[model samples]
Target: MPIEIHQSDPQSYAVAADFLNVADVEVVSLQHEFGIFGGNAGDHILELVQRLRTPLVTTLHTVLAAPDEAQRRVMNALIRSSARLVVMAEKGRQILQTVYEVPNEQIAVIPHGVPDRPFLDPAMAKHDLGLADRTLLMTFGLLGPGKGIETAIHALPALVRNHPKLIYMVVGATHPNLVRHEGERYRDSLVALAADLGVSDHVLFVDEYLSIEDLLKYLTACDIYVSPYPNAAQITSGTLAYAVALGKAVVSTPFWHAQELLSDGCGMLFSFGEADALSTAVAQLIEDDSLRSAMRTRAYARGREMVWPSVAEQYLDVFSKVRFERRSAGAMVIPFPASVGEHDRLPPVSTTHLASLTDGVGLVQHTKFAVPDRRHGYCLDDNARALLVMSELAGLVPLTPQEDQMTLT
Candidate 1:
């Protein structure tokens, strides 16, 4: 459903290869390049998903449109497929539903969950991380345009005058593509803005991929977590979960993610895209330690409910529901009826595309230059290719090459 990035491993790749081999359904993940996929394997999954003899489910991990053309094509293909689309936030569901016009029933929302761990004492964590002297305010995520760092930086100018000891930890490296596309221009812009605001020295830029332990140490060290997201369609953010799990006071924009996460004093929210309001929230947290403590307590409770096992079980339940529906319907494969076939011609695709739907290891139909590859695989790209080679594993659309493309039923 989304990118699963692997930085290293030849043998570690086996786990994914093994998964695709036995999975009851073909799972296609979009956004192959976020270091989520091994290599070209993600692309191969798109071709291989056609051969799976079971249900197909896709997770559009990120907003897929414009900028990334190839990924956008894959996302469109996923939507066009019989596979169901899984989104992470209600707002994301709204985007695909109201804006993209995907059927409401076709999309699902399941928030990302964190581990249910006993939170480290904030004092202990701060001391351990050498951050004891200062109040920590953090924004952790791959820094990018939609990430809302600018708003966070702008809010900081006013915030620092009142709470001089406060340190803003800017976690996460600039996104790889962003660096490639603009050559550290975005990073320079952020640095300049911080400098202009006279809080550049207070901003800590940890410019490396943090390991799990490093991540936890820094996460636990924070006194407060800030997610100043400007764009609201972002489906889910793992940092948001991590913050709540650690019981840190959270101050965030009232985006859909915050709506789902900021419930139960787990944190506080400000108006969307308002820097001054964000400043006010931070000032409130800093000025009132009692309020911060109360928020921290509630944040941990929310995190406890979001542990990975619990969240993962939700997906398992969804899978069970999908499987049960197929079984009760008495057929594993249900065609999109000929009556709805006219809808395929209602709209036009920019290019001629091919799709092959199947159940079991069979070529149910055939047309054009495309044929089903017959091996269902994991969606991560690079690993998909390298892993596929090691695993040593393994369609047809219809009459007239199925030229009518945009079909929704």
Candidate 2:
């Protein structure tokens, strides 16, 4: 099977790769945030993707405001070139439609996926993880001020004093590149806040990034998963997805996906930016064991229907339709192996470049709260592609030779 793709970032590719079942994938170097950010786009990348013989089906990862004119120009061209726009939530699609003027008909909102886990059997998980005796409340993600760890921390003292047996586990550290964005300052701040709250002993902080297995182990042991994030749109929450998959009761301030998923019975929501409200809702769930039980049951059922397999189908369907329309309208079709052999070019970014978006990224804001997610260790999306090249040289992800067949319509 052949589904030719040319993505700009590695983290996005990693999530996208799981849904695709194919042997030959041609990656253009656009995914370079972590690989090698020269503070600019590389010509090898442009030549790699621009020469595509088949129309590319791309997912616009963000709406940036950058100073790099070249990046902006490329982004503009790329959006126009895509067969269809694929996003994880409707808000992302709306951003494209209202802000970028991407026609509403051309976008599809397919939320991210959560892998199957031992969520349905809490008793067995508790026994396996030795959490049978304690009430485990957990929150996992890149630890930054925007993540609202402080809010959860403040809420924790309330939780623990009422039920002293509770424990909260925070899982991963911020991305290495984000260190440029805001370093260990956020992590250090959380540590200090916990100490001041005097819940230092009760709160477990693991500084190293956790593997998926390590993450799952904690999920299995958790009774409640919280997303105290001030900004919801920083990115969709895999933490939330994982918790929902296992059916753990979720207590979160309102975020886009949270609002959508919470109502389905897997979790509950509190008003965003209000710590007292956040605290009260969390307290309610902890004291009421029956509600937690019901939320868990619904979450598992939702996960079966919305996880990667189903989400991938929606993507595939959108790509098929959009590609058909473009082809019908005489959009040139790029064949496999759109050569990277000779082209040396850099399409200038917009006067308003996107990479600059980090300056005032509309944080997804709970009060003045102070952040794949895999530890593949790429600096930005770029680092992953470089690693891909290295892996092929080292034979990490070995290719099994096979033929690919594509039908335009």
Cα lDDT, model 2, residue 259: 76
**Model 1, 223-244: lDDT tens per residue?**
8899988866555777887888
Q: lDDT of each prediction vs. the true structure?
A: 0.68, 0.62
**How far in Å is the alpha carbon of 330 misplaced in model 2?**
9.7
- Across residues 150-195, which tens digit of lDDT does each residue of candidate 2 receive? 7788887777778887878788877686788777777787789899
What C-alpha lDDT does candidate 2 achieve relative to the native structure? 0.62
Most lDDT-accurate candidate: 1
- Once fitted onto the true fold, the runs of candidate 1 whose alpha carbons sit more than 4 angstroms away are 1-46, 63-76, 80-83, 93-108, 324-409
